[model samples]
Target: MTDMQVQRHAPIREQVANILRDAIVDQRLTPGQLLVERELCEMTSASRASVREALRQLQAEGLVESHNGRGTSVTVISTATARHVYQVRSSLEGLAARLFAEHASDQDRAAFRAAVTELAEETAKGADAAALLKAKSRAYDVLFRGCGNPVLHQTVQTLQHRVTRLRALTLAQEGRAERSADEVTAIADAVDARDGEAAQAAAMTHVEEAARVMLAAAEGPPSH
Candidate 1:
């Protein structure tokens, strides 16, 4: 667990939840791993009450599960569940792309292009998973901001944690990181041209390809 300095001005439970969320998405806390409340309290230097609240928040976000006796564990995303997530993600991202292309300011478009360039450079250099994920997230932030719809942004943000975890899985596949960068570049290009339809198609295609790679990887080696 990373060291956390609780901000005196902010709510501790929210801070704790964000910390735990990042750990899960970064794969530091693997799926199905038991998350003991006591250990979490110690790790975050938070009180039991705060830790429990954070766990509750994570559970609501679908990042963790609780059972009567099994305790709390990180949620294991099945291939079927992953497919559903990707379907929704495809629609949301497609809409965001189209909105950005049609309504974003010139400054927003320039910032998005710069973000995509950083993502592409990171992938080309074979940066670690964490770095690549951060770069991609920066690009996404630009997209969400340029979309100019708080409701759409909030809706997508709700699924951010789960989508990030699946993104890590896809990035681990051989050659996937490079292709993923290219896909984003395509979306960026269409956005720059203010081509709403093309941008939406590229964004949806990116999500679809990521789903394909992730589901295939989950299947493991086929029997001879």
Candidate 2:
């Protein structure tokens, strides 16, 4: 194929993967929802090859499962997976916080402060779920990028994608917005103070709270 054709089709595979990943994260696909190749191809307006390649990538990422006769479906988020994800996330985010405290320039800190202010404003607006998610995502992106730790940034990026669905679900729980906003503020304060330990502590607490919220939701409503 020509260079233009190859470049054009590359985005198709990525687009397909993102749509499927979002569906899985939002729980629209759910665990074990069949990801039929023909259906996905039609839904994404891509060729069968692109859809198949996207599915293969998702499967490699542990977001999808495939079997000989059963076809592909969204992978179940087992307790083990949840724990492992949180463990890795905590370490990476903590490292990010520490690095930001130790190495971030004044300008970087200023940018982070602005991002935090924006997050606070967005949260106070009481926007819809999607808006809040986007705002929080942007805020975290700023934080990670400011850390000056490439490895930590990349690791958290992967973890964020893997747990996107859980994060969205947790955001739906009662009091999550308030809690998240408060944590964000705390993290900002710690980083601004240039206290690596405090920043790491704040970040770890924030993630732990999120994990608790997600686990509680996963357990379903309380019994009387």
Whole-model lDDT values for every prediction:
0.92, 0.80
Q: After superposition, how far is residue 81 of candidate 1 from its true place, in Å?
A: 0.8
Instruction: Judge candidate 1 at residue 223 and give its lDDT.
Output: 91
Worst 10 residues of 2 by lDDT: 1-10
For model 1, residues 1-224, the per-residue Cα lDDT tens digits are: 44654555779999889888888988778899999888787677788898889999999999999998779999999999999999999999999999999999999999999999999999998899989999999999999978999999999999998999999989989999999999999999999999999999999999999999998899988999
Question: Judged by lDDT against the true structure, how good is candidate 2?
Answer: 0.80
For 154-181, candidate 2 gives per-residue lDDT tens digits of 8776667666766777778888987888
In candidate 1, stretches whose alpha carbon ends up further than 4 angstroms from where it belongs are 1-10
Please report the TM-score between candidate 2 and the true structure: 0.87
- In model 2, where do residues sit more than 4 Å from their true spots? 1-10
